[model samples]
Target: MNHELSLDLVQSSVLAGVLLILGEFARRRVGFLQRFSIPGPVIGGFLFALLLLVLRQADVATVEFDTTLQEPAMIAFFTTVGLTGSLSLVRKGGRLLIVYLLACWTLAVVQNLVGIGLAEVLGVNPLLGIMAGAVSLEGGHGAAAAFGPTAEAMGAEGATAVAVASATFGLVAGSVLGGPLAGWLMKRGKVRVPTLVTASTGSTTTVVDQGSDTGSDSGSDTGRGPETENAEESGSAGYRKLLSTGVLVGVIMVLGTLLGTWFSDTTGFVLPGYVGAMVVAVVFRNLNDRFGWVRLDSGTVDLISGLTLGFFLTMAMMSLKIWELYALALPLVVILAVQVLVLVVFVAFVVFRLLGGNYDAATMAAGMMGHGLGGTPNAMANMDAFNSRFGVRSERAFLVVPLAGAVLIDLVGLPWIVWCMNWVG
Candidate 1:
């Protein structure tokens, strides 16, 4: 009854790939999964975790995985995120981008404070509260996996599992509530979606003329900034492009690991390796943008990001020891529930008004709920669903939400959360 099965690094990595494929397959087949934007990896990985939980409870063999590649994959994905954060894009977003970014940063701080405060009241580790807070909610599964080990090292038991679970809750909660919140705001304000006109040239062209007070067309330029130039560089064959990107990412990861190790040793402070990699990547990205030193392609970077994030997330989810969270379960539920309530209130009252309180603001509010409680993808899904229903796309919402949620928000949120962790530890 004590049998154990251990998988080596290669086997574990392959299994993670299979799980990713399985998740994608299920998503393709399941309509609700697509509607909710539930990630394939999460679907597959969580199912596996559930199976493991049942097997363990039934006294069946327990399996162990070697997640040696998980860290590297995580760092690579963050590095790609760093590469996307161009100063020019931020500038293009103008005043509204600054406001939205500030809102997201504020949310991270609020989430942590509320989480830690409720944790003390609930008689649970404050660090576990942090795990359930921004680390899981705003940070999503990626941040949960990255910071789980840090929390565990700082004496929080089952931090990874708890954070992962909290993130999953946020993903679903954000998806379910975002559109409704936006819809309610729009209905109350009598915000009307701008008419979308279709012009038929040689090819059919659709134009969005958003001249209504429902949204501000301040920074409505839909160009992707540096990505537009980079897309041309991606004209090479797919395999060659991927290989080149891999090499560049590998080199950056190495440098980042070294830089993080050095910083930690010198300052006696813990700096996650991904942080260093992201910093280096940001520098490289900006420098490349200004000088065009390397032919960096955005498409390839996105590809790498998708692949690494999928594999890393699957590995992290499948390895979760859910049984360890039983003692902290009640506190975790309370903290997550409160976090959801706070995000809803904040988006409805603060984020909507600040973003201009138009139809555009309503769409962006839906996006804020998406990324505020979940991740950027969830935010996009929320906005997309809202926009599709109204038959209008808020260019401003698409630009600001994805840019801030995915890149700029992390710039402020990460350091603040890290400081809180160090202080609590």
Candidate 2:
């Protein structure tokens, strides 16, 4: 007998929350997963997905989810990312950002080339390779979905399944790869971690410090205490600023949607809506930074973003169509294996060398592995894992990698990936 259960949007969200709780518990209990820096959602969501597969195979039950909240969760998560795009933070990374962006663009090109080449070797469509490459790997699931329609329209069978599967593979691979690779680089290079090493430079000030810079009327002056600003911003004034920032974020999202639609309609080249939101968000953040416009609190922004990202990942993992992976599974596995080899070589040699070939470079290597392999969070998890043991100051890496992944990749890299997709299709 087969049972079918359909859940409403709220119920599905509640189920997602349950999955996240279970995921967190698993992270705490599973030593191997903990040691390797496996994200809680990845474990829990994948497990659930596997269970779904087993049930389907057994003819036990079919579960249907109203995933209405997933897209909004995605948008909200990215919006929080956008809030962090202060020009000041961008300025902090300076040339490092420029080089990393170039490296990422180069990586995109190489991924496409490698993917397309593998398709040829396997006697498949080049478009399949492109979808599996930057479109899925670097672009993650969002880009995969965006590009999937076009691929299907162009006669690529099971395009969506391949893209999603590859991205899922990337998340796990990226997480596993980053920590160990960083550890090797640190051990081999004899890199110094700031936590372990003395602060030879004058101030031990951090982004959090600059973030609290609410009191200073001028950019040169330092920010006030976060607590002080928190206290002051709590009254009517704070509430007002909070509302204003939220409104602005909403407006940015709407505008981004419009812009992306316009571009896709007019240019015949497509982009994600979040790209527009982030671009506008960065502009707003910088303007607010300079003009004291409605007192943006970094802590608040982080809180909103963190919650959204957590939910977004949970939904993303839970919704994986793991059963669809059987088509071209052998070839897809080979393609992914080659992509890993390429990523390892690039991170081990190219990334480490370009960023100064020092301790900072090593830390950034770990961080880049996070975003490079999956997304920004994996990069943080990788950096966090490496930092926990080695005691390195990865502040710059934390700032730079996320910025590049969230903003630059969409702006600079997406176009190239789309052009390739269109060309191949």
Candidate 3:
């Protein structure tokens, strides 16, 4: 079984390249994925997983599950997440953003509780279930990778295997839950799609005109309607000032990590380098917003996110052992089933009411369902599905959901999990 090439590295690199090419191709040529309820990443990942299995069975390719690649990708993804963590977005979203973030945080907590309970009942280590269901499933691959090492340190066997299994199941469940929940909410509320019209005059009108057909209308007649857009534009500026700000923040984070490492060495207190990076980013974003020094570019944030996530998914998929998952099949199925039920009921009743029982509510719920179960892509897919049938309010969903999935909730989830671990421990 010895091979010259590093099997995991080679396989993941190859898979990422293939996914990028196929993703672009499918996005351009086969619009069915965009038209239909399926998510592009989900489709890509599923096809890749199936292909890997087929190749393995045929003895055409061999893959060794390498856990090492997971950390760098995870750190890169989280750093991207942090770079977008401007308080401006939160301020712009206002009460609605707060509600959504709180809802997601609550869901993460509930997910962990459900996992722990299930594991205790099934006589497996509760930490294993917690890692699989909450950390991996709700938090996606980044959290899975972050927690995998922690799980091992805490005495959970096959922590990486559990993380992989949970991430796979999360992808499937997240994609499935979002569209149906949004559809159901729309049906229950009798929400009607608004007539979209664009004025041909004025800069504001021109911007509106361009985005109107795509249903990105936000009711504000301003050139830039929301905080997210502003932050994105601010962040995207490639000027010396913006680049300097980003670099300064990056340096601060690096310095913080070094300080933490030294402190840990001296006082037996451990700090993750990514955590230091995130803290620095958060602080800088807040300071920038307060002082009007520089803005965060949405395009840059999105670009970093896409590249980091692509690499992260590649690492995750290449490290999967299909055979190992077979052993945990029964519990995995049960956990997924419970998660699906929980999401459906939560979105239908609780989330809708909190969101004011409107079309936007339905769309937002769909996005949350996608994120809570899968990740940001799934959330976007759900919104896309809702938009295709009944014109989407793109700004509302796009601004809110991405902020929730990409930054706020992700940062918040880590500390909450640590708190839970302490309480349980």
TM-score versus the correct structure, for each prediction = 0.89, 0.75, 0.74
Predictions: Cα RMSD each: 9.8, 8.1, 9.1
Pick the lDDT winner.
Answer: 1
Model 2, span 291-316: residue lDDT tens:
97666777767766766656766766
The Cα RMSD of model 3 versus the native structure comes to 9.1
lDDT: the better of candidates 1 and 2: 1
Q: How displaced is residue 353 in candidate 3, in Å?
A: 0.7
Indicate the TM-score of model 2: 0.75
Q: Write the per-residue lDDT of candidate 1 for residues 1-425, one digit (tens) a residue.
A: 85699999999999999999999999889988887677888888888998999999999879999999999899999888888878788788998998999999999999999999999999988999899889988899889988998889989889999998998888889999999999999988888778789897687789987565655544358644444556656655777888998899888888988988999899877788898888788888889899998898788999999999999999988898999889988888888989988988998888889888898899999998888888888999999999999888999999999889998887778778887887787
lDDT (10s digit) by residue, model 3, range 135-169: 88668866776676666676776666677667767
Superposed Cα RMSD, model 1: 9.8
lDDT of 3 at 160: 60
lDDT ranking from best candidate downward: 1, 2, 3
Better of 2 and 3 by lDDT: 2
Please name the candidate that would achieve the greatest TM-score relative to the true structure. Answer: 1
